[model samples]
Target: MTDKVTINIPVQYEAIAFKTKALGFDMPSDLQTGSLLKTLVASKPGGRILELGTGTGLATSWILSGMDNHASLVSVDNNELLINVAKEQLKDNRIEFICGDGYEWIAAYKGASFDLIFADAMPGKYDLFEETFALLKTGGIYFIDDMLPQPNWPEGHAQRVEAFITMLEKRTDLVLTPLNWSTGIIIVTKTSNKI
Candidate 1:
């Protein structure tokens, strides 16, 4: 008899997994979540990607594996300890690891819109949905993860997902699909700039 489970992970991502575990940072994206990010990134060749709350860069590695050579990624995290681990692990020219308040950085950014944005931080912490939406090019994908109830989540955390859903539903500029996979993900695409 054999008990087996198989999943293919890129070498960079594998390294991030080990490093994150060694650092006791359990917030790294699971394999399924990472794979999903890779798939999405692959869809947009030369995409400009933004990742908030870069926890150990497991997902960043996956995204880089799929992104085109011309694509660029900016991953931000407030924790110096965690971001430094990611920066050292992923020493690629295509990626810029920013150690600072993600919200503040995004708020001050006055550059071209992104092709993809992955919001890995807790959903409710982001109060700049309009700004984020504006920063995403029309038809660009915005991913928000960890929306489902988790074993470690405090009581009432699920309500945050609900409120987020409600907010998305009210917005006419974006289309939303709430998927019940890998901690639940809300996939939002900017369909228009209009309110």
Candidate 2:
């Protein structure tokens, strides 16, 4: 067996997970990914952060706890029910939980560049990679996880991931690396603002 140390789920996260299970939502970010988010947010301090999918607020809790007061997070979800549950569980002034279509929301959003973005929603599927990349500040990091080979993945899902990776590889403005970690995270950093 591998000697991977088990990280304790914080009580807040446990509550969120409990709620998620009660709602039959089993797709929240795993502990490894959550921990990585915490670490990433912690390093950014007062930077602006965005999460595309606010599933049960489990990952939002992790990000909020790691961020300072000066930082702000905008997390969006299309499901009103899920967004409400997450808002209730994660009562934080710094986080703006939105319920709407992720694609349309990003399409209309003219907000400042984000220092870090967790594209964890349907948009995270890389359909809007170029638009999302443009939202990132130069030197900003974009995280897309749940990429590890999943037995439950629908047929042809792997092909989409492969095509996305290939597209990223050809980009000259950003540096992309696929980390073979928990869910095969593709970490992208915008090296320049040019398209």
Candidate 3:
């Protein structure tokens, strides 16, 4: 059995504190929120995965741990310092770490597709929703991790994010399920036949 996982506030916070102390890369998600990175990986075995953020490689480790040995992951982040840390922490051959702006990477990967896309980059920085949509294979999973909820959610902020969710829902090609977990997760599975 996979060893049980424990959540320690002190260690988790300390990890962020240590990384921030050594490298200035900002981290958007805390250890408490989001589906267990490990859980997602196990559920989507043998799936090609893409993660937009690799902060301190914490979640990176979780994803790698649960993924099938043959499945590959392309994890991206603009922070060289954080990426470097990830390199050492995540040494598995199945994972590729890239350092660059998420926008640039997403643009380049527009036509390419994957079985799963995990976005923990930032809260409202989800401006690339359309571009992201273009990169998912049919029956693929597009998961958005609410790194943080916009303060103006009530004042139309939620509307903007919700708009993206609404747009995806309108597409008969995809089955959408808004997962009501920590923070929030919008899980979209492509059901459309169109490429």
Candidate 4:
């Protein structure tokens, strides 16, 4: 069997990838991760999705591809230049791109809770972990990548990854499964509002 992932890729993916490369942004989500995000978004029809990192909108394209017409996405990133690349390529009424700090956005967002959240940035994934998780509705899906070691990982990042995994394992309000594929993903489902 072929090990490659075969799915209907987003039309804007190639352009976004090219812009990301041209801009020298090295942290875009991998193809495998994008595939998973697309699949996960498909599961939530008319869902309100949140993407914590809009790195050239690589993952955003995949998420948008999976969303139904009634669904909407709010993608955030701190870099204006990188986010602009995504805004230029993926033009859909369903998407709202925010060029701002993911951490601050999470803290200040008082809108409806999200059905699915893709935390590819440090805010939702590392910095304000619980606070961001709190934004997930009951039974909502929380997705994050980069759990595995990568060439770009800074020193002591492996230790941080281990610690994050340990913390997730101890959370009783949610159920999580760690996948070794696709840059090492961790998919979590919120079971309760309580921590």
Question: Pick by lDDT: which candidate is best?
Answer: 4
Clashing pairs in model 2, backbone N/Cα/C closer than 3 A: 148-183
TM-score quality measure for candidate 2: 0.92
Across 26-93, the per-residue lDDT of candidate 1 in tens digits comes to: 67787777888888999999889998888888888888888999999988889998888788888899
lDDT-best of 2 and 3 = 2
The global Cα lDDT (0 to 1) of model 1 is 0.82
Task: Estimate, for each residue in 1-195, the C-alpha lDDT of model 3 and write its tens digit.
Answer: 543335423223445446655775444444533326656667777878888887777667667766887788999988787777778655789988988888888877734577888877742136676677667677777777662364424566666676666666677777877766556767667776653
Clashing pairs in 1: none
Q: Which consecutive 10 residues in model 3 have the weakest lDDT in total?
A: 3-12
Candidate 2 — what's its lDDT? 0.84
Candidate 1 residue-wise lDDT at 147: 80
Alpha carbon lDDT of each predicted model: 0.82, 0.84, 0.67, 0.91
**TM-scores of the models, in the given order?**
0.91, 0.92, 0.74, 0.97
RMSD of 2: 2.0
**TM-score winner between candidates 2 and 3:** 2
lDDT of 3 at 16: 48
Which segments of model 1 are wrong by more than 4 Å? 1-8, 123-125
